[model samples]
Target: MTSTAASPPILQFTDVSLGYGDFTVLKDITLNVARGQVVALMGGSGSGKTTLLRAATGQILAQKGTITAFGQDISALSAKQLQAMRQRMGVLFQQGALFTDLNVFENVAFPLREHTKMSEIEMTKVVLDKLDAVGLRAAAHLRISEISGGMARRVALARSIVLEPELILYDEPFAGLDPISLGITAQLIRDLTNRLNCASIIITHDVPESFKIADHVYIVGQGKLITDGSPDQLSDSTDPYVQQFLHGKPDGPIAFNYPVTPAFEQWLQQRKS
Candidate 1:
């Protein structure tokens, strides 16, 4: 389905609370990814950015509220229906989780083979086109072990987009990358979003890079949204926590202490007993 500027969002989450079992990692989450928009989820580690991605993919049901993707409410979908919906979405995992048993070409070709009955010639052309988009067509025959970290990330990106999905979810895409590779990957993501005219949700902690490419940004902390706005708005925020995070300050609203009994008090109590 093609989307225009006025079309409804391709993805939406409304008051969603997500986590496993008894603990909630993200609460009252409301976000959307419109066609041709790049939305970045910014937070520190354990702030539940990746959990939101998982909820969007229907890998985990929200503890409360609803998640809608491709115009369908995810919680209402049966297993088969959810699986079908997921076929239209692509995901680039945090670690570039490529298939070790497959070479670069085969890794990118896997989705095409699994989802479509394209002929061998057609599949080869499509796979090469995707790999070429990520600047890795020359290394098509190389083993996963033979590629550098940056190259492997490119291959993962290629694999994710080979099917030409309408939505792409990137989880920690810039994690562990050097400055040069990080910048290159960020540009590649922005270019792909524009070229394909698809919506994207990026889960990341890199503030400057996220602000650089994002059409909208949502900052989360302690399982709640801290602020949401355009890059400029966020940059100009006066919220103490937002200011600290944006400037990479050592101290601010966030506390470093773990929620545990005070050590000196515990020792005194034990001695008295």
Candidate 2:
């Protein structure tokens, strides 16, 4: 939702609950991403951080409550309307989901070619500029297979912001990078969030890295928001769930094991006898 007129939130989820078929992934999620802010959604695996990103980008509709983007209700939009809305936003998947058949330049140019009537020369300039932003302009001709993982992620980042999207959604942006690459990627996220002045939501399990890049953070657990605040506030929180997650503890308010029958343990022990 690219709105230069006012700095209202580019993305908002109000009392939203989203799910797949019979299983709910995120419940009662009320969050907002105003322009120039980078918000991180942090949680353990299967805790619905990625699901929240999916909901924010309209990949899934809310089963309950409202998911709004660009100042409009996502659930109310038609298919065509939703597609148009998505064009104004950008998404970077966990794996650099570049086209296997296309080189770096073409991958970044793909969106401009599909969405705009810009001339090839103009498109080339835009693509190069984005590549430069992520320090990948020199590797513009490299195929996905030829580049390192970090370079691929940088290319993906370039492609995501090529269109100057008002909002960007990043899913596990630091998933599989070396220490140096991880640091570089984290810095890029912080720089781009401020450079583009765009609202962003980063969904990641990497607590330290996410905190370094995020202006605000929300922690989720069992389909619900456990807590939210600045990095320091979250670190200083007394909430058991927040403490458990930040400290990487095995036992706390959130149990380590899934529900199971108490008698099953004894039954297995008896059978061994």
Give each model a TM-score. 0.92, 0.90
lDDT of each residue in 98-127, candidate 2, tens digit only:
998999999999999999999989998999
Worst 10 residues of 1 by lDDT: 255-264
Q: What does candidate 1 score on TM?
A: 0.92
Per-residue lDDT of model 1, residues 1-273, tens digit only: 223448698998899898777667778989878999888999777777888888889999989998999889999999999989999999999998899999999999999889899999999999999998988999999999999999999999999999898999999999888999999999899999998988888999899888888888899886688889889899999999889888888889766553333565677799999
Cα lDDT for residue 131, model 1?
90
Show model 2 residue runs off by greater than 4 Å.
1-6, 258-273
Error of 2 at 80 (Å): 1.3
Task: Compare the candidates by TM-score and give the number of the best one.
Answer: 1
Number of the top candidate by lDDT?
Answer: 1
